[model samples]
Target: MALVIGVVSQKGGVGKSTLARLIACNYAASEWRVKIADMDLAQGTCTSWNRRRLQNEIEPKVAVEQFLNVDDAIKTGEQYDLVVFDGAPHSTRKTLDIADACDLLILPTGVSLDDLEPTIKLAHELKKHGIYPPKISIALTRAGNSDVELAEGMEYVRSSGYHLLDGVIHEKTAIRRASDEGKCATETSFKSINEKVDQLVQAIVNRADELGKK
Candidate 1:
């Protein structure tokens, strides 16, 4: 059985697509058959990205396809070890439907109240709709300064009664630049940022492996 991971958020530019691609590329590199379902049919961000990734002939090749329906997307999971879903930034029924189907849901957001505010609301909505608390987590991406600040952000997320991912994607131009060229954050220029990406990937993949056995 495949582990279906959904990278979702109600706010735009929160690095949801980037997170999805990171997961696919990491698993594919590790030789764990991977495929990405670009559920944001309107934007097709992951679809276009996969096209560039192929054109550039990037190593550890992974595949991606776009689908409008969650059921159709879910069907693709049977073919790979992992299926990463990059969903739209909307509070529509489709978003919740995607959340309902995933084995794990990753909500990427920045550190401040502006980013955390809407995310908090969405967290409540997911819980209200019966999304298992352990299956959902808030990943702090594009975070601000220092380990201290990141620790504070973690505390804030915990205080809000939501689980926080262990890895933080700091604000780094190297990450975005690599994405433009069809490269994963792990392949970016900064070793520090790359390490962060790797750590998060490890945590998420471990969870998938743990759940897949059940």
Candidate 2:
């Protein structure tokens, strides 16, 4: 069976789709057959991004499709090595479905209380619905260049008694530009930015592996 990963959020513009595409493309580049299930049907974010990627003829060729239901995505996912669900913004019944379906559920948020509060609350909701705490992770994204704020954000997640991923994806114009060109954060033109994103990616991979063993 394919390893399923979900990128979900309490609200939009919090790097949810960004993390989904990043994970899909990195696994695909490593020669793994990867599929991104774009659960945000109204937005079709990953679906449109894949179209641009194909047009650009980017390597490894990640497959992306919009699915109205989690069951259908899981059924289709069995054919690939990995399936990444780019879930819709805001909590819905489907959010719990994704939480139940995925081996790893990643919640990406910014440094502010606005983002952090809802992200942790969603995590709590998932737990209330019987989702394992270790199976869920919090990733800091679109962070400003303030070390102190980043550290505080990390502490907030940790203090909430949830696992926090090691690295932060600092807000960068280059990353946005790469996405506009159908590229992931790890595929940016700047080597430094690519490396920084890779740290978070590696942490994600490691967390998934650790969870799989349990």
Window of ten residues with lowest summed lDDT in model 2: 205-214
How close is every model to the real structure, measured as TM-score? 0.93, 0.98
- Give the 10-residue window scoring lowest on summed lDDT in candidate 1: 205-214
lDDT of 2 by residue, 105-156 (tens): 9999999999999999999999999998899999999999889998889889
lDDT of 1: 0.84
RMSD of each: 1.6, 1.1
Off by over 4 Å in 1: 146-148, 210-214
For lDDT, the strongest prediction is 2
The residue-by-residue lDDT of candidate 1 on 57-138, one tens digit each, is 9988988988888888778778888888898987468778888988988899988878888887888898899888777888
The TM-score between candidate 1 and the true structure equals: 0.93
Give me candidate 2's TM-score against the actual structure.
0.98
